[model samples]
Target: MTTTQTFGELDHPSRLLMGPGPINVHPRVLRAMSVQLLGQFDPEFTGYMNETMALYRQVFQTQNRWTFLIDGTSRAAIEAALVSVLAPGDDVVVVNAGRFGLLLSEIAQRCDAKVTTVEGEWGKVVDPQAVEDAVKRVRPRLVACVHGDTSTTMAQPIAAIGEICQRYDALLYVDATATIGGMSTPVDAWRADIVTGGLQKCLGGPSGSGPITISDRAAEHINGRKHVEAGIATAGSVAGNGRRIASNYFDLAMIMDYWSDKRLNHHTEAASMLYAARECARVVLEEGLQARFARHAQAGAAVVAGVEAMGLSVYGDKAHKMTNVTAVVIPPGVDGDRVRARMRTDFEIEIGTAFGPLAGKVWRIGAMGVNARKHAVLTTLAALEAVLRGEGYGFTAGAGVDAALGVFS
Candidate 1:
């Protein structure tokens, strides 16, 4: 029997989200999102939009003029970059090392690109030589990869790969969704033609906005495929002679026109998410990118030290591991989900469970954005130690917290 029950004013439990993503939002970003809404085409709103673009330029460390926000999550930006630049039957080489890497290949295939993949071990970054060899042999039009795949907690080295793409005259697109504000991603220095990221990870905001930057080389290709919708098409609108992009919402050229002085109406802008993204960038820049990176690095190291001191093994090549997330191997005979549940129920904390081949074998703990701090790291470690002990996992008492504090001290 169902009975109508009116829901009361919204309230929720407070939890420490020490997981792969969708972590706690920054208080400043939350406040920014609560500001009064503005008309999409209002001068003040457009001014905020322009400020967002300029702010992300500093965030992405690029001077590219086409830098802007996509009114969607990280994957939307990925699709936009690929679908706009890759026409039917174009060759693309994707490096598939982790879950996010596989996602790159999946999205590329849906775009009708003849996708070839270069595989790497799950716990390791892709080898630049392998990518170079594949590009040399395949002569691909595009090279796509993830900067950091949280699934495996591995951060790929992309500078040399970018140089290889340049030598072969191929466009390089990177999903920096996991690494963007937590670490350094110098788009121009890395030679990435297109780079996309989300606000949820290290940006300390909600997941609705995707910040992206494109070099002139990549922009030219996307602009070539620009086609205005018939409903809004003007006499001045140039009918794109190229193949129409497969997805309307994910089209970059039209999005650029909407963001430009043309002020062409596309989809109504996601106003609140834009404000959140703006403030996320503002907070990050105010802290200084390098300092933010260092803080995350220290927090990540604390996680590693504490986990190891507690007799758990840290997964992946430490040298290439992301500075915001750490993967710890689940101890023998310990039920991963059961331990995670105790952590949640008793400690009000959440750590990540792994995916793909890594499932059942490891737990991922994220220290990024608003949660990347000494207290957050130590709190998670303390909770994890207690949970592990309850799960019949033996460890030296106080070792984890002690080691973690050592790092901060």
Candidate 2:
């Protein structure tokens, strides 16, 4: 006779989660996820979604009336934003500084948008003046850039680029998934029309939830294609046939209507993930945006100081380094993966490996969100110093921690 094995939570495994995303979740978020489920259309749940939207608006620093979760990971949010805006043969210029920007251009191409690019080296940021000059030359329909490209630990300047797009009458879109919440992103001041981010990075939550905010200007352009159900779209609500929307799932026109007074159906919202995203935003506001930025700023500085004290050099322009993550050049003769593995198993600590050309050459270290604290920063430094020493690198013991402590002091 065949027997069934007992299934339980014990069967699960745990990870240190020191990579690019899905960092260690706050305990409060875990508890929130354990709460009982509610019907998607239930009044209380709908209220939760509204609350989530309001909280994200404050996080995004936007007064955009149409903000909501995209119900997937960060890439899903990217697709939704690009697909809805790009029709066949539309022109798009992606300022490619790293992997994410390339991915965006690829996705836009798949959506049939004619794509162009201004490429930059992997550990370097795109110059705003170059982007402005490109906008004058390309005259594309949309200009998309990544605020923080984790693959390179570089943060591209967006303010002037947005200004250039404004002059050219092209919409400005930013993928801030790796930088938002951990860094100060004044969405309104920057003139970003569509901003999309993930819950995993900087937000102190798991993946599977993406929150996006779209300005009324962007909504107006998207609303030109409002294609709701024929029977349901009433006389005053529905637009002409030319205004019918493109993708049904990512239709921001109808999405805004559903999320707002229209109160129409879309999809089953991810209730637990929404709660986690809401709480993450709450933590940022409660701490005050300035204070939150200072924490990440200090921790990132401390990490850099610590790494330098160990006789290592950090990549990229120091002025352009991201507030949350850093890229340190891996010294010759030391195995990057071995150092990372030891940091994980021996110390219960984690650090990231670099990608692209910098892969195997730079170590990506993060001081982000909930992990941006004196304890995590100093501990990671101490552990790394020890591991590098054990691997026969000539370095003084406690050098990393001492350097970091000097900064905190």
Best by TM-score: 1
Reference-based lDDT, each prediction: 0.92, 0.83
Report the lDDT tens digits of candidate 2 across residue range 262-364: 5777776788888888888887788888888888899889998999999999988888889788888989999999999999888877788876777799888
TM-score for each candidate, following the candidate numbering: 0.96, 0.93
lDDT of 1 by residue, 1-409 (tens): 9999999988878999999998999999999999999999999999999999999999999999989999999988988998888877899999999999899888888888899999999999988999999999999999999999999999999899999999999999999999999999999999999999999999898998999999999988887666665356435435453366877788898898888898878899999999999999999999999999999999999999999999999998999999899999998899999989999999999999998999999999999998999999999999999988888889898899999999999
Regions more than 4 Å wrong, model 2: 1-16, 230-246
Which run of 10 residues does model 1 get worst, by summed lDDT? 233-242
Predicted structure 2: lDDT: 0.83
- Every model: Cα RMSD to truth: 2.0, 2.6
Per lDDT, the best of the predicted structures is: 1
